[model samples]
Target chain A: MLAEMIKFEISRLLKRRTLLFWGIVLLIALFTGIIEYLGMGTPKRTVFDAFSFSTSSIMPLLLAPMAGFFTGGALVEDSRSGLLSLIFSKGVSAFEYVTSKAVTSALSQMCFIGITLVVFFVALLPFFPMGSIYIGAQHYSEAFAYNEPVAYCFLIALLFITAAVAFNGIALLTSVWVKNTFVVMAAPTLLYMGLIYVMSMDATKVSLIDPYANLALIDVYIPVSILHMVCYWAVIALITHVLAIAAFSFKKDYM
Target chain B: MNEVLQVKSLTKRVKQKVILQDVNLSVSEGEILGLIGPNGAGKTTLLKIVSGVVRASSGSVWFDKSAGIGIVPEQAALLGDMDALQNLRMLSSIRGKIGTSEIKQTLKRVGLDPDNKKAVRNYSLGMKQRLMLAQAIMEHPKLLLLDEPTNALDPLGIIDLRMLLSELAQAGTGIIIASHLLNEIERMCDRVAIISGGKILRQVNLRSTEQTPIEVTVSTAYDWDILKRWAESVHVELQKLTPNKGLPRGILKTKMAVSQVISELQSAGIAIESISHVGPNLEAVFLEYAQLEGGVYR
Candidate 1:
């Protein structure tokens, strides 16, 4: 049943026009470096620099909003379309249904971000060189000199995926109560921006909670900071999913 | 027949407004029970509770767990993005994976095209209704609940549904149909339960042809008092009709067989002008219990 549900969820997500919208966003992300090279006097000298720049700078902006827009309507559409009663009547418990939806949304966002990063890297290879890459503080750049730049790029992409999962969880939780699709789509973006603003105001207090902040430090910590950020975001995502399940289970009225 | 469903003292309170109150009913295997009521009479609520889509505030509903259940709500609950075959495939998985050929056969049984590729969103209201019926019967559930099942059906479709339901009932599947069409209920149900104000007003046994009361009207030469005494001696209720242009008239009400009633009246020496049998039709019984002043019945 779980496998079937996952298949259904994936198919449902793919069929929506939202997938097309997200596909267009990914295309835009893929061509950003070429567009930048044409506009600026000098391009990033190596593929690692271009990949890191795109993953850290542009991916978060696109990833969170895309996850938010799609997750926002994940559960709401079933209720609005009068399919909830049919689903529940067929013996699919609310918990199972919500869990399947949450997992499917998170996995989809992960794949979307993963694919975009791969495309961005491949597209930049012809234009940028594979050479000794400079990262982190000018003085500390040598401290991490032994690590491969491509590996570090992957680390940053993983961090962004973690942040996407957390955002998707928040979006799924919001969908438990908010039936309006527009509100579901806009909430995560607003929340992400709000988190960023708070982190900027007080780095000490908010950095531990802010997913994007950890992504920004990919060049500094190399491995440890990225792992810590991933764990932090994953825990938050799990909590939001548990809350979503509880809210859905306790709900007596599907309409 | 074994009892297939038992709903006891079921009550539903939605945000301080009571929707169903102390409703108790049952259906046995092979029995087709009709739930007849006016709007807001809690017929749909009862079905929802029985189907497990809505939780009841109080009371219990017990079903024969071995038998699968099927339900068709007033609004057909189908995924609009999916085509007809896909919708069945998704719903059929709940009963443990029904094959495509079987689903196609079920659709054909419900008068739907097996190969139609149109998405459910484009289906007309009647087509959607047929699809809903098709899904409900796809698993061959032992208990089926239908709410206003004929809402979008044409005359032929309605007849087809009636025949399908009869076939299911004959095959020993219990059915509880809630509908406003009393004539359909009269023809399809073995028993009819009239519900009003969240309570079942009465359960009429349509199969008990002998138990139903028959009304007898007579134009007689005897006086009203004489006819009244004869009826009283025969253990039947008698009403004296107003004399029509100086002609004596009276009516007799009894649960006896028609032949017995005729013989009793003939033995009483009452001249039978017209021996007309007025019915205890489901519609009359339904109205008697559904009206505002009808009061409660067990």
Candidate 2:
């Protein structure tokens, strides 16, 4: 059932009309790498920096809210357009319906991340030789000896993924109550930004239970505390997602 | 016959307004039951409740001898971006009932080309409705519930649906259809329940062999006393009666000789402005009952 859901969802996302959104995102990532390469005259940036540049600055603005809006929109559209009814009519319960969506959206996000990893790595491989030349010419030979922050990069990558997965759950939750995609997307994004702003005001007491507030922890280097904080938020998101599915299945009516 | 669906005292409320109240009805195997009513009469709501898409505030719905219920909502609920075949696959795979071949057969019966790869959004409304119906029938539900199944169907499509439903019923499936088309209901239903103001105003059985045929009409400038006396002189059994303001309308029906009524009208000097022969059809019953319930029929 999960496989079938994934197949149909991927088919829907691959439709011609939706291709532009995907194209634009990929183009931005490629262009950002290309411009940075041309300006610096070399690819001295580490893999961590490349991934960080793509996910943090470019992807965050669109990908974060887009994933949320898309998930939420799909849910509401299924209900309002009567697609949900047709599924239920076939003997599939509400629990299966909501779960399949969450699963599918997470898988799609994972696919996107995988593609980004491939694209950035392949693009930067050719420029590494030139990067060595520029470093030698600048008399900064120690630049080649710089150790890759493999652990920190992996942690940040995990952090980014956790945030995306949590947003999918949040989008699924919004779908139960808000049929309009605009409202669903805006509400969570605004609340997340609001929480981020509030956290900036007072960093004394961090509530790791709130996933929205946890995005702030991703910016700095990965310490044991931040990893624990991310894990705490992940647990909270999982619990909220379970409760959301319960609310969707056990609720008396659509509001 | 095995009972397919049994709904008892089902009530639904929305924001303090009653949408359905004390509604009791059942559909048995090999039966086609029509749920007919005017707009806002809760016909769709009743169907939704049965389909499990909408929950009833206070009621119970039991389906067949089975533990599960299948539903086909009024809306064409296919994914807009997916083709008809894909939609069928999604629904069938989830249910774990029926196979690709079964879906193809059902779709073919409904004149939908399962091989066509056109997105559902590109399909015409009639085609979409047909696809939706195909999805429902493919489930092979013991109790088939539909809401305005022919809403967007063309003349031929409506005929095809009627024939398909009849065939399904003959195959031991119970079909409950909610529609405003009284003529179609008259031609199809084995039994019918007319609802109004969230209440089951009446239930009718079309297969009942015993019935009385009567022609009745109320016009202006007719005295109630004279009409009553004239009806009595003819010895007509008032099978069903209701006051239409001062012009009370009654089903002055009888199995007596037809000549008896003519002779009595002549003898009593009763002016017969107009009269219609009401048969065991839904139109007359719906209109009469709707008026009796003090509701307007649109």
- Highest DockQ, which number? 2
User: What is the C-alpha lDDT profile of model 1 across B217-290, one tens digit per residue?
Assistant: 45645535566788788788765444556666545667676787677767877665555555446755764564
TM-score of chain A of 1: 0.85
lDDT of 1 by residue, A197-246 (tens): 87778745555655553234444443335557778888877888788878
TM-score of chain B of each: 0.79, 0.82
Candidate 2 has an interface RMSD (Å) of: 3.5
Residue B178 alpha-carbon offset, candidate 2, angstroms: 0.8
Cα displacement (angstroms), candidate 1, residue A103, comes to 2.5
Off by over 4 Å in 1: A1-4, A7-21, A29-43, A131-136, A139-147, A197-203, A213-215, A218-224, B211-280, B293-298
Backbone clashes in model 2, listed as residue pairs: A89-B71
- Pairs that collide in candidate 1 are none
